[model samples]
Target: MPRQLLTDELWEKLKIIMLKMGIYDKPCLRKTVEGIFYRLRVGCPWRDLPTAFGNWNAVYKRFNDWSRKEKLMGIFNALVVDPDLEWEFIDGSIVKAHQHNSGAACEQETAIGKSVAGNTSKIHMAVDACGLPIHFSVTGGEVHDCKEAPKLVAELPKGDYIVADRGYDSEALRLQIKDKGAVPVIPRKKNSTRGNDEMDWCLYKYRHLVENVFARLKHFRAIATRYDKLKRNFEGSIALACGLLWLPM
Candidate 1:
C-alpha cells in the first residue's frame, strides 16, 4: 500500500511541479521517488526496499543526481513559506558512519577530525521556527560544532537570530554572525575569558525546535543507520525528508 502523505489533489500538483522541473521525464522517476519515500517512512534500507517499486540502484542514482543539483532544496523551498525568517537555530548531530558509507576516496579532502566513536560524520543544520531546515553542512564528527557555525549562519537570511548552545560560543562566530547582521544567541562557555553573554532564556528554550527537527530527520532509518555509500545520497535523503516535513498536516 502507498502510505499517502499527500492527497490526490496535492499529488497532482506535485506532479505538475516535477514536470515543470523536468523531474517527471524519467520513466522511473515517479516510482523511484515513491520507493524512496516508502523506505524513509518505513525506515528501511535502499536494497531492502520492496522490488515492486523498481530497482534500488536506479532510485538511488536519481536521488543522488537531484541532490547534487539542489533539486530537493528547490522543491522544499517552493513548498513552504519562510516563517520566522529572522529566527533560526543551529545544532549538530553525530551519525555513526556505516562501513557502507565509507570508501569515498574524495572524503579525504573534507575529513577534518574523528569522533570518539571512531568513524563518524557530523551534520550541522540551521532551521527556522517551523522546524524547516534552511541550510546544512557535513563534517567529520570530531569537528567542533562552533567551527561550522559560520558556514551555517552564512546561509541564513540577514538580520536573523541564530540560537545555539555553548558549544558555539566563540568570538569569531559572534563576529561572523554580526557581520551577517544576525544576532548570536549562543550561551557562554564555563571556562570562557569573557563573562556570561546575553541570553534570552525564554527564547533560548525554543532552541529545542532544531533538536526536534533532527529527531524527525533521524526517524528515517537510512539516515539513522546510513546505508548509503555516498555522502551526496545521504544528504539527498535528508533534503527529501525535509520536503516531507513541509507537507500539510
Candidate 2:
C-alpha cells in the first residue's frame, strides 16, 4: 500500500466531520480519502496514484467534486474550533507553479502570474495567536501583500492586535485594523515620516508564528508546488492542508 498519511485516530475525527458535512460514508470512502492524501503528500500526477487506493480517476473526480462544492473547505472550517484571538498575524508566500498548470481554458482565472522568480502564485494567509490558519486567499504571485490585506483584514475576527511585516505597512491598512477594533502592529517603512516608535517589538517577534504556519503547510508537497490549473482547486488543496493541521485538536 502507498504510505498512509492519515492515522486511524485522525480518520475517525475526519469521518465525523465529513458525515456531518453531508459526505456520506461509503466502503471506499476511507480509501478514496487516502488516495487524495497520498496525492497531496506525494505531489504526484493524478494518474500516478497507486491502485491500492482504487482507481486514480475516481479519486480525482471525487476531489474535484468536493472542491467544487466547497465541501473540503467546509471540512477545514469545521475543524477550526475556538482559535486564540489575542493576536492575528497575516502574511503571504509564493509557490512556484509547475509547467503542468499551464494551458487553462481561461488563463486569466488561473491565478498564475509572473514574478521575479518566474511563474508563481501567492498564498495570503491569516493565523490566530496559536499560529493556526484561520483564513487564507490565493492570488497571482505578482499581487502585492498590501493589495490583498484589506479583504483578509475585513474577514478577521476582532482581536487584540493584527500583526504583519513591513511589506504590509500602510496608513490606510492601519486605519482599517483600527476600525476592526484591533491595533495594527505593522512597522513603518524607513521612508515613511511616521516612525515605528509605537510598534510593539516584543509582540512583533511573534510574527514568526505566521511564517511557521506557512512552513508547516508547505511540507505537504502539493502545497510546496502549484499544480492545479484552477484557482479554486488550488485553494481547496490549501484548505485541506490547513485543516490537517487542526486535525489533532
Candidate 3:
C-alpha cells in the first residue's frame, strides 16, 4: 500500500466539506481518494495504481468524472479557510510537459506551449502572508509573469499589501493593484530611474513565502511535472494538491 497522505483528523474535516459540496461520501470513498493521492504523489500512470487500492480503472474513472464535472476543484474550494489578508504574494513557475502527455487525437486545447524550454505550461499562483495558496491560474509556459499579474490579482480578496519579485514589475500592473486598494511592493526594474518607490524592503523579504508555497506544492510529483494533456486535468490535480495543503494548516 502507498503511504498515507491525509491524517484521520484532516480526513474528518475534508469529509465534512466534501459532503457539504455534494460529493456524498461512499463506502470506499476514502480508499478511492487515497488512490488518487498515491498517483499524484508518486506521479505514476493511473493503470499502475496498486492492487490494494482496488481496480485502477475505477479510481481513474472516478477522478476523470470529478475533474470533468468540476467536482474536484469544487471540493478544493470548499476546503479553503478564510486566508489572512495582511500580505499577498504572486509568482509563476514553468513545468516541462512530459512527451507522454501529448498525442490526444481530439486535443482541442492545452495550456502547453513551445519555447526554448520545449513543451511546457506555466503555473501562476498567489499565496497569503502565511504562504497558504490563495489562488492560481495555468497558462502557456511562455507567457510572461508580468502579463498575467493583473488577471491573477484582480479577483483576490483585497489585501493591505501585494508583494512580488521584479518579474512582476510593471507600471500598468502596479496601477491596477493600486486601484484595487492594495499597496504594491514590487521592485523596480534595473533600468528604471525610480528606486524603491513605495517599496517595502522589510515586507518584500517575506516574498519568499510564496516561493516556499510553490516548493511545497511541487513536492507532489504530479504538480512538479506536467503529464496531463488536458488543461482541466492538470488544474484539477493542482486543486487537489492545494486542498490537501489547506487541510494541514
- Most lDDT-accurate candidate: 2
Can you give the lDDT of residue 220 in candidate 2?
A: 88
lDDT per model vs. reference: 0.74, 0.93, 0.88
RMSD of 3: 1.3
Candidate 2 per-residue C-alpha lDDT over 71-187 given as tens digits, one digit per residue, 9 for 90 to 100: 999999999999999999999999999999998886447889999999999999999999999999999999999999999999888999999999998889999999989999999
Distance from true location, Cα of 94 in model 2, Å: 0.4
Candidate 2 residue pairs that clash:
none
The local distance difference test score of model 2 is 0.93
Identify the candidate with maximal TM-score.
Answer: 2
Give the per-residue Cα lDDT of candidate 1 at 149: 75
Q: Specify the poorest-scoring 10-residue window by lDDT in model 2.
A: 102-111
TM-score of 3: 0.96
Worst 10 residues of 1 by lDDT: 104-113
TM-score of 1: 0.87
* Model 1: per-residue Cα lDDT at residue 20: 62
Rank list by TM-score: 2, 3, 1
As for TM-score, the candidate ahead, 1 or 2, is 2
lDDT of 1 by residue, 1-249 (tens): 556355666666667666666675667656777887887677666677777678887876777778777677677766655556668888999888766666666743333346798777778988887778777877778888987777778777764787899899888998888888877788888877776647778879999999998898888777776656656666777777876776652
Question: Candidate 1 vs candidate 3: which has greater TM-score?
Answer: 3
Q: Write the per-residue lDDT of candidate 3 for residues 43-141, one digit (tens) a residue.
A: 999888998788999998888878888888888777668899889999999998999899855755678898789999999999998899889999999
